[model samples]
Target chain A: MTALEKKFVSFSVAVAVLFGVPQTVSAMHIMEGYLPPAYCVAWGAVCLPFLAVGIITMRRLVRQQRKTMLLLAMAGAFVFVISSLKIPSVTGSCSHMTGTGLGAILFGVPVTTILGVIVLLFQALLLAHGGLTTLGANTCSMAIAGPLLTWGLYQIGKKLRVPRLPLIFLASMLGDLFTYCVTSLQLALAYPSAQGGVGASMTEFLLVFAPTQLPLAVIEGLLTMLVIMGLETYAKTELHELREGRRGLFHDAE
Target chain B: MTRNKKIVVVSLLIVVLLIAGPLLALKGASFGGSDDAGSVKVEEITGGEAEPWATPVLEQLIGGELPGEVESLFFCLQTALGVGVLAFGFGYLVARKKYGGDRSGTAGDKEKNS
Candidate 1:
């Protein structure tokens, strides 16, 4: 075929492909019923301890300082907003932000864990984005593991005296990346490669997720930094109180 | 806009660019969900035997899968609820700073002491 004709044909083919199929709105959350029953139960069992801790921490914060309830709601809202946005990525696949990092940074791991699970539960039931059966697995990756890493990174960065913005950015971004990594590992564990085993299967899932997730992580990090800056600007007193309360609580633990 | 407002606007623009840049650059690519991609891989690995074992409750109740529009509506509602709560929180903070004045500090201190 001549060059112009070939170009025309390829353009038509692309248009056809785009319009031909009915698009299913699958999302980043492992879809409902995706995992086997045993795997689902196991993942749920693993999350129970974290959920318990999150509940206790949240209850204590609300009871001790009533003002924190509003902040906690805001944190949950942040997760909801960030995760709901499925931004397009370089891989030509869409993914979402965890938004757990901001909560973890602001409120710490246990409260963020609760926020993440709540968001996941809402997404699963209301939007059918994630499944009820797979809620445990999703909670493990998105809520518990992601926020834990973000909180740990934030703590370490604070101790190291890193600048606030960069530290928040790194913690949020890396936390997001780590969540996807955990997700890949979860999927690989359930369905190991016959030829190459779990390692190979994990590598495959990681490759599939990485391109979409990397850019998303950066966006999430930037957005989180901005939100933190905004909070510092407008809610200085509340933020200060939260910090003091966190320190006091830690001291009590020690 | 003030300096902080300017920064927020620029950062938001950058975020917009980050999302839009990929779509403009990668013409004709279907920006499918990564989860869908992961599921496809699972299906491939399992030789097409890795079907989802349960239906979403909504789908089950409806006796069919949700149409794309219905799904989008649900997503929009979710976003609306979140944005509403966020707006309320920020507005409350700003109002407290502006009008509540000493009352804000006194209330906060009371909570702290208690």
Candidate 2:
């Protein structure tokens, strides 16, 4: 390898070591076959409309501006990296960030939906972290619900004239938290509590996820802010176009 | 490092601490997966009637579960592929800035003319 390539490889290794060392066998997604066939089909059906819209939006954006393809790939990559890091938490349980916030902030909800489904699909097929049967339910919670919240928060924050960095942090962090909330709800719906019905079951699942996810949300937010900062510094022109609504992804961008 | 770089580094250190501090202080906490916890809770809630009814396709093909090492390998490969693409995007953008010399204006002009 050339000197630059060597340096890049070493840097990547250092990153892998830094994040990968603390990992345990903690496959935290609603694992394969965890949901019943009926619930699985229901969730999968729910995703079809949103995914259709997402694909349409993505296609329009790519046709309008080819540069968006690069940013889209980067956003997808961010999701992959962030989601794979199953960080340990104070609850003595481990969970991972959804990493959908950055994309939601940059490209809005529809594009994020597409990015999320692709990543979830890979995890299901390759790593067996999530299963194909459960992909629809998982996609609904992690991709659609999470990014929707993030995009909404970002748009609202912008309207309120919130500072950029903290806004990014809150939107990203809350998006991660909200993904788990939706997951808990899905679980609760699938397996309602006999004693108190779906509410009690949902609360139980939420409490189980909260302690681990709270810290993870904060970490995801910070990491997302750092990435945005890096992009603002280096990819100024591209971000400017994206933010300007030239790509027509964000409502406020116009 | 520049001031901005230092700030980024320190923030990263903070992130590291946030992750490690819990693992260190918890002292023998199983660090179990919440997904598993959720499953166990479901079983308890349903009086052990709610077992997962399907197996992963790969596991079905192999007639067994994937080994932990292989699972980690797949996860690493996923992360590596993502990081590689992300790096390429950033590198392309940076290189464009260096060589293309502020072409956003021209691109916009071209769009307007078209």
Candidate 3:
């Protein structure tokens, strides 16, 4: 195939991947039925308002930049590709990139969030990767929590006048790390330690995951930055309009 | 080459370096994920015999593990569907913007007035 074809293919595939982790340590999506019904319900409930907001945000974005629709689609496809590719982490577990933050950064928190929930749901049903019950928790960490972090960081980056690429790298990295941290905490809450209880359990999960998650976060961050740069070149007009639309949003708020 | 073209080329090179750099550096290494670590961590904290609070609903429904190939096929199909929906959706939006003109920009216009 031609280089153009390859680039298009990668555009669909390579938004995020890497720093890597061991699958045995913690898989990408919490497997089906991994969380108790109560945890599932609680997490699912937590996701509702975010998703509602996301739906609203998505509509607004479509109106703001017609080309944003394409960006949104590409973002979703990117998430699917990255999450599906199981990478070998240094620690001997098969892990995958969350790709949540990049979506959030590109499309805004709400729409990227909805995309995450839908993608997770699809993974649960189609690939048997994650279960239906744990959808809420998975969505919460990967979609809601991670993207929120990205949006906040992105805003801060804008205010601080940080170079766009570096800011994106940092935001993407933090977003990926935050997801693992939340997932670990979720697991910790479910099963507290013998002596120190929940805190200890949380600590234990963090320690175990840190070995892989730390590097993976860095890899993901760089990957996200590179992808955005690519978009800057290929999708310049859409990005410019989108940036203008976002600026108008904040400007209006003031 | 144009600036955009140069950046795209450099970006591709960077991507190639990322993938290859790691493979070479981490040769003979073990790569894995936390799928089972969460469970093991729970077990260690609670002591052995820590039963899973949940089990795979799909597994119970299917009565056993689905073949790996079947699972992979589903994943591929899901990716294709996701790509198709997103591409088509975006294409429609672009076309609409091209023909319909820019009514959406009206909202941003208000910002200028204030």
Candidate 4:
């Protein structure tokens, strides 16, 4: 494919992935029984390695910059705290993003996974965010999908020679939206509507989650972009020094 | 204090804050632990409650802006997942040490080579 074709194709895929899918898949907890039993089991199975890799990476990296890791963990804690304050969206339905871009950007995927998992776990135990049985599926949706896709986007953006700001923005946007998409897909598969039709529930799920998710993704993207830009411009030297010079627990380059 | 000492102390403080801060807030905010029926009555009408005093702690943990119920679920789940991850690490470490296998590389390496 030509360069232009590749870019278009990339952009189109990103758009479709972000927009075409139902918002439920793209945004919410996507309750457990929404997918087929087999699908949930399979997705949960697929998630095991991501969690494992995330843990090991955290272990190794946490040693390199204990201070940074602790700071980041504190940040993760903050994310959890702020996340608890909810806003009403639907009458009985509401949604929130993990705001994981910061964690993912600073500490990388594995650390983000650990952070996401911790956040979700507490949510389950304390606040009943998602159900106990659905924890695996929820984890795969937010912890894995958002950060992994964000990381992938980061790679692609880097490869395309995109600037850091736009790259981080795109990554954050894609990550945020892809998470909702996966969630919508899971919901569609699990709690299919009784329209006696093909993909009816999934269609509904998409419709509901789309409007909310689309704007939310853009907002998250902008926020992530701004935060990353600030960090890069203001603390470029300090962050670089910490990343390169310090032998701490959270080092990814090592 | 020396730079190393500062780092160590600050690091400890961060860790303590991350862990203890949450526990304390959760403790202090425990409606179960309080005779704050007036607060509960207010929360019932408002759909949620807020402790002005706990704002700083909550802000310290999650961020400045608060999320809605769904998002709150998302955050709570996020923290739970993080705990699971740390627990898994301890489990793996213990298992590795006990089993004494050469699983020294990482799950990522295994995925890559496979």
Between candidates 3 and 4, the one scoring higher on TM-score is 3
User: What class would a CAPRI assessor give candidate 1's docking?
Assistant: medium
The digit string of per-residue lDDT tens for model 2 on A115-177 reads 998999888887777889999788878988888888888888989999998899899999989
Candidate 1 local Cα displacement, residue B67, angstroms: 1.3
lDDT of 4 by residue, B26-107 (tens): 4434312111222232233334532222222233456553355655465556556545543453354445445643234345
Q: Is the docking of candidate 3 incorrect, acceptable, medium or high quality?
A: acceptable
TM-score of chain B of 3: 0.56
Prediction 1 global C-alpha lDDT: 0.80
Q: Which segments of candidate 1 are over 4 A away from where they belong? A: A1-28, A247-254, B1-6, B100-104, B107-114
Interface RMSD of each: 1.2, 1.5, 3.9, 16.3
State the weakest 10-residue window (summed lDDT) of model 2 chain A.
Answer: A19-28
Tens digits of lDDT, candidate 2, B46-75:
999987778788888888989999988988
- What lDDT would each prediction earn against the true structure? 0.80, 0.80, 0.69, 0.52
Candidate 1: clashing pairs of residues? none
Q: What is the lDDT of residue A170 in candidate 2?
A: 94
How do the residues B31-104 of candidate 1 rate in per-residue lDDT, one tens digit apiece? 99899899999998988999899988888888887889988887787788789998998888878777865356
- Residues forming the 10-long window of minimal summed lDDT in candidate 4 chain B: B30-39
Question: Candidate 2 at A75: error in angstroms?
Answer: 0.2
Give per-candidate clash totals: 0, 0, 32, 60
Q: Which residue ranges in model 2 land beyond 4 Å of their true spot?
A: A1-28, A246-254, B1-7, B98-100, B103-114
Q: Judged by DockQ, which candidate is best?
A: 1
